[model samples]
Target: MNAPPQEEATSAARVLVAEDDDAMRAMLVRTLRRAGYTVVEVEDGFELGDYVAMMRGHGGTLAPPDVIVSDVRMPGLNGLEALGRLRAQGVACPVLLLSAFADEETHAEALRLGARQLLDKPVDLDVLKAAVRDAVARG
Candidate 1:
């Protein structure tokens, strides 16, 4: 695959996406790929762990991705809790939270845990793409 464009590549990035719904996940992959990013797609927190492990295995001194986009709710593990765990473990990738709608407490917890963006459901694809792009850039 070609390297991501200068304007779109994260400062120290590779984008990771975590969403459970297959259709939504596929749409996200297609959208991000079409936008010139090489996105690492995962279905849930376990898969996220696997991906992160693989990255750490090969990501070397650079560590893992510069940014992550995650769905808020899922079975087995919820995004907020998993990300909090990741933070505790020092993953440090800036995260963007996506959900249909979350309680204020969930929102506050995400921000408190260092989420870079929190988006409601029925997302605007253009905005989602832009948020990912910008978040990656910032990272």
Candidate 2:
């Protein structure tokens, strides 16, 4: 069988978003989409893992996302833990972790786990966009 067409295989720089708050998730999806990225939205870290697994299960046939944006305090595995797991599994996409609680330990751990940026809650859209742009550029 022939491989899918390149245009069909890839869209604009892809971004995976895992935010537990419905409103926040919607806003992020809208903003990222408006910014010309293909956005995949999930409710929590577990769902984010599932999405990653689905992509990986296709072997290297699928194009992994350029960046991930996740909430720090979500159900199941938190953003940092999830990012660590993905890294362990050889997923190199940069992650931007968002949190309302800005604990030093969490920040340190997130950095250790390879999060590109940790933005506090009520994140400025411009800052968030800039961070995502930087992450994608880094990759």
What RMSD, rounded to one decimal, does every model reach?
4.2, 4.8
For model 1, the stretches where C-alpha displacement exceeds 4 angstroms are: 1-5, 8-13, 53-63
Q: Tell me which residue pairs clash in candidate 1.
A: 100-121
Candidate 1 vs. true structure, TM-score: 0.82
Expressed as tens digits, the lDDT of each residue in 68-127 for candidate 2 is 999999887788888877887788889999999979998999999889999999999999
What lDDT does the true structure give each of the candidates?
A: 0.78, 0.84
Give the TM-score (vs. native) of candidate 2. 0.86
| Candidate 2 residue spans exceeding 4 A from truth | 1-11, 57-62
